[model samples]
Target: MTVKKGLKDAYSLKTPMDSVNLYRAWASTYDNDFAIKNDYRSPSEVVKYYSKYSKKTDTPILDVGAGTGLIGECLREQNSRKIDAIDISSEMLNLAKSKQVYSKFIEADLTKKLNIASSQYGAVLSSGTFTHGHVGPEVFDELVRILKPGGLFIVTIHTGVFHNQGFKQKLSQLGKCISPPVFHKVNAYGSKIDKKHGNDKVIITVFRKKMS
Candidate 1:
């Protein structure tokens, strides 16, 4: 496989297999080659809103699209609860496993019904998943389905996708099931060598499942 590792390759993904293959090869160097090199700040940004809005409870947390455990590492620092990870790439999950941040690492596609039970998580957090050529708002129903009543659902959606994609419409469709979403603009990367992507930004969407 021709392993072309760059933001363009990630942004150009058209299918789940594309993600699987790309990350499978890129997993080993993902942190350094892409994340650190670009001064990726999405994970920390997700954690910031999570810390501000979510209660530190024993109820398990699920990190969706948890590539390389970046979010998991941050969450581990804040809470020592049972945090589980779900991602499509086993290679990425393997790297995440080494961090020892997640109690469970699940390899599954978010485009399908996850093996997880409904209302099983107190909070579901994700970063860098809802972007161009990646999973879209289509998975929102399933993500929300896994959250316990009153549980928090926090994720970072690339600003462009949030507007251009169906995220706004999907959130409205889920309005009955969840509270009004709170969106926060966040820098997707800090000081970076990648000038083209240095200005990338995201909207950290935070909302809670309704307690009926």
Candidate 2:
């Protein structure tokens, strides 16, 4: 797919390849154009939940779909160290690396086996990653695999993905591996400057890996 030039066009992308192309094109101004412009709040909300439950600030935390490191930046504000980032777009990852917030970064698709070892992170945070045509419930097992036993993970999923894509069923299938999931409503559009920016529906799920 030819990369779209506008935020509206980016949202219309329907495939992972389309996502890759779009992010590559948007990397330079992603934060300003998308997160800030749309009043994106998933990163800060995910971090708020993660910090409340997580005791250590220096332990490794993986930021899936870390994008231009928006979540990493927010994580740092909470005094979090040892943050690692992974995104499918090298362009985005490179921009993230430039911020010096994440300890490391890897380019990989969420729907496949990651290059890192299992049980490597103390916690994981993701936002704006699971949505239309990006990734689906298939990534759950690998997410569980990478998190240490008892590791906490907070992620936001598009409301459509959560309801229409059998995310609840996938949670049921992994009952043996994770704690019961907790759902939090996320303002899909929380622009402080835009009074009418809260119509989109999304949910943030927080859960923990279980010890074998």
Top lDDT prediction, candidate number: 1
Which clashing pairs does model 2 show? none
- Model 1 TM-score, all chains together: 0.96
Taking the tens digit of each residue's C-alpha lDDT, what string does model 2 give over 1-212?
Answer: 53435546555778778989888788887787677877777788888888777766325889998988988988778884788999899999998988889888888888778888998998888888887767888898998898998888889988877878888899999999899999988677774535533566678898889888
What TM-score against the true fold does each predicted structure earn? 0.96, 0.91
For each candidate in the order shown, give its overall lDDT on alpha carbons. Answer: 0.90, 0.82
lDDT of 1 at 26: 89
* Poorest lDDT segment (10 consecutive residues) of candidate 2: 1-10
lDDT of 1 by residue, 23-78 (tens): 98889999988888878899998888888887865268899999999998887787
